[model samples]
Target: MTEPKTRRTRNGARLPADQTTPRYLGENIEKDLREVSERTGGGTMQSRILVAAIALFAERGYENLNMRTLAGWVGLKAPTLYNYYASKEQLLVEAIELGMTDFFSYILDGIEDVPREDRLFEIVRRHAGYKMRHRLIARANDRLIDPQFARMFLPEDTARHFSGRMADYRHTVEELVRDYVADDALVSPKVATIALLSQCDRMAYWYDPGGSMTPEQALEQVTILIRRMLGIAA
Candidate 1:
């Protein structure tokens, strides 16, 4: 019999929605996928550690956030923290996967649901809003797994897995572009997708929900930008 395929929270081409217990929360899911080795001092320890990791990673960037520092932040000995993450690379990979999983499962799902012409605008707005809402996680994702910097953090296996997901995710964007172009809705599908991703990816760096605009307000502005780029009358 064929081996049962593991029910992954992430995958290439299409990621499955998280059906697991919502209690297990974090951007880095690989750490949580393994059997728990670190005993929780309290029920909230896991959640706290995850948040701490995100904050620290955002502050220091992946290159500087070593295991020892990470462990110290969580009040665990470096060796003892191995109970939670076998290695820093594995942990980084899992975190990257979590962000992408959310990206595809929810954000891309929204793109797929709407009609082709409106899809790109919806994608840009939602993508910007998501990065704003999950700022720290989004910043880490942008820096850590970028192709030029990927080798410093991800193991070979992790890189392969991540590359697969990224290609699949881009293909989804490409499909939308193609549909819009076929209908004369977009001037240049490839350029449009590239521009959209570039614009949306930067939202993490500057998003401030408490600043001059709320996320909804920002999303509306981004929607207008996308529509203008597509030459759609507002």
Candidate 2:
């Protein structure tokens, strides 16, 4: 397989784009911040900085970016930028936090009030849909935030809450799987969880619009796969 291309974090931190670290949501956040800034005729300095950083980082991978360049984008001196972010790394962390929160929030929205039997289907469909909708950001997160890269920035480098949120949300999914057992569904909880994640993860590598399966169809098929995995009566 070809190696994943390099991508920049919203904070302009250089990392691989083939992993899972949340940062691109800052792009959306930045856009919203800019819109509010324009409409209200004012925006927080920090918000402008994030918006600029999102653009700069996305255009130029982190390796080609630096605090000075990022500061210049926001019309700030490099030192002034530090007033908002201790380091570019911290800023990247903030971006990642934004991205992850949005990611899971959509999943929660998808599953909300969904019939219990359809909950898993909705979760996977929404997840795949969200990722497809924001494929670039998703790819960047996947490439950049995999286990090793994340370890490089934990504890001392980021807020405890932001750093741990991904793990916490992931455990939440596991809890949802356990619910299947509680309902006396005939699935092995372990297999169901693993299968679900694996199936979803494959979307990142193989989502093609014109390749026989529409996203709607793909989701329906996966939903049925999960139902079968759970041994729910077909």
The prediction achieving the highest TM-score against the true structure is 1
Q: Model 1, clash count?
A: 1
Q: Residues 33-115, candidate 2, lDDT per residue (tens digit)?
A: 35523432247676566544544455454445567767755667888888889977667766565556556776785465888
Write model 1 residue lDDT over 1-234, tens digit each, in one string.
Answer: 453242322223322222222111234433322212132223344443554455455445565555666665556777887787777666766556655665565576645568877776677767787677666556655665677667766677778888888877777777776754554554567677777777777787776756998788777777777667656677
**TM-score of the candidate numbered 1?**
0.67
Candidate 1 regions exceeding 4 Å error are: 1-58, 61-63, 75-77, 109-118, 182-187
lDDT agreement with native, every candidate: 0.60, 0.60
Q: What is the TM-score of each candidate against the true structure?
A: 0.67, 0.61
How big is the RMSD of model 2? 8.1
Q: Provide the RMSD of all predictions against the true structure, rounded to 1 decimal.
A: 13.2, 8.1
